[model samples]
Target: MEASITFGDDALAARAAEAARELAAAGVPEALAAGDPTLWGPAAESQAADRLGWLDLPTTSRSLLPRLAELAERAREQEVEHVVLAGMGGSSLAAEVICASADVPLTVLDTTDPAQVRRVLADRPERTLVVLASKSGTTVETDAHRRLYERAFRDAGIDPATRILVVTDPGSPLEQTGIESGYTVVQADPRVGGRYSALSAFGLVPSALAGADVARLLDEAAEVRPLLALPEGNPGLELGAALGAAALAGRDKLVLDASLSATTGLPDWIEQLVAESTGKQGRGILPVAGGEPTGVPDEIVAGIATDGAVRADGPLGAQFLVWEYATAIAGRMLGVDPFDQPNVAEAKDGTARILAEAGEGPLPTGAPVLVDGPVEAYGDLPADVKDLSGALTWLLSAIPERGYLAVTAFLDREAAFEVPVPPDASFEVLTDIWAAHDAATLQGLLAVRTDRPVTFGWGPRYLHSTGQYHKGGPQDGVFLQITGDVPDDLPVPGRPYTLGRLQLAQALGDLDALRGRGRPAVRLHLTDREAGVRHLLAAAREV
Candidate 1:
């Protein structure tokens, strides 16, 4: 498929056309391509100056091809065929999409769940090459992952320098760490923001190392790069105008359906790009990914298969470029800075404070108001609401018109848990937790009760992604968070807290951040994940 976009129905198309016309008159595309930072006004000019490097990444990122090829060849020569990616948010999402769309195998470790970490460690670490990616070079999750992989390689009697590849900005702490430890470090373009780094080293390096066609990806992106600077008939501008116009018209819920695209996980990457980039300043677009939405007035489906108002059909690389361009334009229209994620650090700070306050035990949280079977419901459950179904219904009731429900899961996302099923449970939840099916199930369950869109995000991982939007964007969102008891908790190497503790802190931290922002949110802890999943599933079905 070629890289391009199609405007939606009559009203949306007209609105988009008018918005695009306004943008053309204002010289949005030209200014963006010329790296003029003043397009975003005074509030964002400084960041805009530094963050527009992505505009040229389609060509500039090609410089890394040789080094990436060398890394791939080394991995082959060393008999290290397995690729494990340890990154969060933008650091990993782009690579994750690239490898997935290319049908290559790259194990993504974007979580702090002990079971998840344990599963990664159990993989063939001896022959696994771990790509440690962190834009800030100081992310706790990436550092913990680096420590574990280092220890794992050491325990397996392998030199970590041969197995560790570091990706970060130059002069960052991770680059220094990689250099001090004799590991190869690929520094991404410092001027590129994390979410917009799809065509840069951060996205290209890991995918190249994992045997994806990095060159072809770059070629595809380059094929569509020129259109981004065009005034009219530009796919990026058209799509962005449609998005901004819709949001401005109170149809801010963006339901993305990339089923028609050649890329498998484009919607997810776009979700982060748009949500993080636009969802701020007390107003932003909310991306409802991977569902069949009815296309309510507050919702616009950006489907690839002609199923929506904004049809974004493109090859993987081109899709990334277009989405980045469109999200930037949308950010300009929405009156927010697309480059900086202002509220992302709120959850991290909360996690730190929680970890510091909790000492060695479970993160301190107020007791669950209701415990039904294996499920423990935290958050505001009305005194009269006794069952899990009732709690879910109450949360659903909190979702306002033009608002959305965000279902976040903090559990080990396994394909299948081998735990014994509880006899009293209504049914078995066999497959959702691993793929975050439980959260999705609850999302759909709650979705049917209201016309509003519902979104599902994996925990701590989302903290680096949509957590910014949840805290900083519109105040109409209602949240349902799922976290469970980690019986076999694993500790971070040389750290006081376990991965389980870190995961819990992240969950509670985000929960508090949402609550502190006056957003209605709740946490449901599964006492016995298997039984809890079963109960949660059954209760959601009832809700």
Candidate 2:
């Protein structure tokens, strides 16, 4: 359960050593441990003061044990052992890993895709416990989810108050709504920021309900927590120095090696934490959730697997605490406020504007420049491009030397892709092909074709995570947004727009925000999900 870090390369080791020397000389570790908000300078002091409570979460969060246990027991007694968590960003990511590591069931609903939403509704509501989590209580996606679930439960003749649980900061908009609706509301530490709340109530509540060993996680974190205070020997500080050093040295793209985490999906959590915290003022670390990608000279390999110098090994709790601390340290080194996401609102505003302009008409889905079988391309394309292969090649060529290509898919992530391996094919081939069965295939295909990092995320979920970095971070990024025509668009219970429209608007909103910033962006509309994905896979492979 002890967390540890070691260097595997001379460059990383030397750079980390230099960074550690400077930080130690400035008494940074001690200042951070002492809760000195001024360490981030006068500009960040006010926000830092309200965001440092995470440092104490390992021990302070233990008080929630009895409450979490009682809720779990109550759910079991009611034959509602299934836990459906509706949250975005850090609120859900922490609990996700916790449950995955423990081999428990947790259904996470963090998307605006109606297909994903409908899939969750198919789960028997009477036997489910829905946890509504949002720090601000006003996140458009979370709010929409809350409204849908409340209706779903009521339709099942189950009182939402009995089946629902809420987690948010005290005085948050959700807290008031939860109280008014007569649901159990667990107020988290307001001082802890969303991404740093891995050890707080936001993390423990859903995980404990889903049968994770919540107390043991805290114990593991507590054991490694004290070492974070030592400037030189601290694992967190060392990792931070290495990360900062790597980014400053022009290797800012972090390719995650999942060999260490296995099924825990720790890299996905780390991706949001680092990207959102450090990406600001036209600078940030872009986390690529994949193993050591070849040919990207600007890529830095780190995570559980591989012999990378910047790696972490430990239990989930210790892993969470160390990464949170390291990200804060990296933020300081990057000269940005780790607590604030300055540009996250741009897409939100765009989404609202697009929705408002929709009025009583159809959502504003712009015209596509090229339409090939089941695939339509939006945004300006290179002249004389005849087919999907040509279009993909042009998109790959748009990425700058140190820039990255991002693929955001507004589709169901869990849709089954049953790849039938040939009798002569190896198991590895089956698994590999299954991975490329969706728009996500673009990441691997495009990475091998270009000398830049490629990142892929299921949409709307990322709008609350890496979406901050995409627009606010380094301006060198080129984006590929993939949207599909929904087979059956479901309407929002009380809202005017359907889930399909909302998702398309979310995609359209992001396209506007990225293009407005002068970033090269394109949209690929999948006219048919299965056919489009296959065509996409084939075309991307050719790129």
Candidate 3:
């Protein structure tokens, strides 16, 4: 059956079709290496594009639908009220999509946040089901979350083995964990990478349990495969190729949007996918996550220098119109050959190594106050990072020649209540404490570019605005995630739910939601109470 197309605008479809053809041709190797040698490269480009064609290998993701339906039935039979998907990257992205788009309330935990662990245990009812998803059966985040859940189950007098669900490749570490622990186990496709596993049971079953119309999603995905295979007027392939070319050309980042619950794992997933598939040499698309209404980058000022000078030279001077046009003009500029990014594989290997070293089959680091700073932004800050003061000076000193900069702050409930915000419908749920910082930051960003409007919101609150505006909105925004490490971790009173564990669990949930949106996200973990106010002040400064 042909997937139904809505939005009821044929004119728009026609316009997109015209642009898509040009883009596919540009990204396609044969078309690029025409009579004009300068138009494209030699043999490499053709091979690269040919390799990328595997994106369409699964002509139809038919199996996921029925599996999802069956999982949904199982959930109903068990009367599961909530599901916590414990995995990092691809294992979790598909689950995120389902949870976000589905009618039910679901949460994703991708971090070892003590606060989050406490919250989940406190909130988890007797009917809660924990799905441990790790394709290779070894991801630190997934293993950690699974252990936390298992511990909770044992503490609550519930059989740990009976309370958990396992999804991974056959004979994988996670599968072994399930078998040894006596949990129900399901296998993922061995041929699929974590990034591509979204179309497999890896993504679908969790989404089905979360209440998404998995059957419709399967139908939607199936329709795209053939279109992508054609390479002309195919949005998926065109987008992937275009994005790949853009990364090769100079644009290094591609921010994506997704709902809070379902799409939380997308950032890690996309990061792995694009980084592994296309990050050849020193080039690759750095995918980050953002939420709806809030995650959208309010402004993209390309030429702002550290010295406060705006130079319109070289590609820096190019306008958004040019970027838009180039998307179709250049297509997959890397040619038709594969661009193997070994670092991508290495990173995964490292994670596996750490997990395997643990004696407990699927054990991971327990929840903590914080994870290390961003791998990319490690030394970017100051030696003494007690508060926001050092962070501000760092931003001013190392301002990009022409790149995006944002401030992320974590405010307490009281502080959040004092913040102001826009009149948009999405901000209604945001408490005053959270709005105070968002409003102040938005104002500061706007001051630099009054012509461009700003978008902002609070976490756990703006999640509701995800559906129509995020994945559906215009894709030209940057994101900054500001959060605070709560001094006192909240825990479930009197139970096995420890405060530190709970905090970590909730933090992971918050982070996964933002990551799932697929945008450029920087986490600013405030150290103390004063750090929140200081962070707001730092955001207001012009570097």
Which numbered prediction scores highest in lDDT against the true structure?
2
Could you tell which candidate, 2 or 3, scores higher by TM-score? 2
lDDT of 3 by residue, 1-543 (tens): 232112122332344345456655555423332212233346444434432322332443464556666767877897888887777666775567456545557777654445545566666657888888887676655665776677688878888776688889888988887998898887776655555556666776676777766565555554444443345433343344445433443544444332322223333344345434443443334333341122223211111111101111111111111222222232334442223223333323433344346433422323332233321121223456433434434444343432333333223323444345566736455654464444344435432542222334333222211111222222333344455555666433333443334333333343343345453444554445444444444544533
Taking the tens digit of each residue's C-alpha lDDT, what string does model 1 give over 1-543? 677777657899999999999999989888876889998889889989988999888789888888887888889998977899899989999999999988999999999988888888988877799999998899999999999988888999999998898999999999999999999888889999999988888888889888899899889888888887899868889888999998999888888887766677777888889889988889999988866687588878888645678788777778888888888889889989889899998899999999998886656878889998998888876799999999988988878876788999998765244444455644334333342334456666667777778888988888888888898899889999998888998878889988888898989888888889788888899988766877887888787
Error of 1 at 56 (Å): 0.7
TM-score of 1: 0.96
* Of candidates 2 and 1, the better by lDDT: 2
Model 1 segments more than 4 A misplaced:
415-438
How high is the CA lDDT of each candidate model?
A: 0.85, 0.86, 0.45
lDDT of 2 by residue, 374-398 (tens): 9999887876987888888887888
| Per-model TM values vs. the true structure | 0.96, 0.96, 0.60
- Once fitted onto the true fold, the runs of candidate 2 whose alpha carbons sit more than 4 angstroms away are 417-433
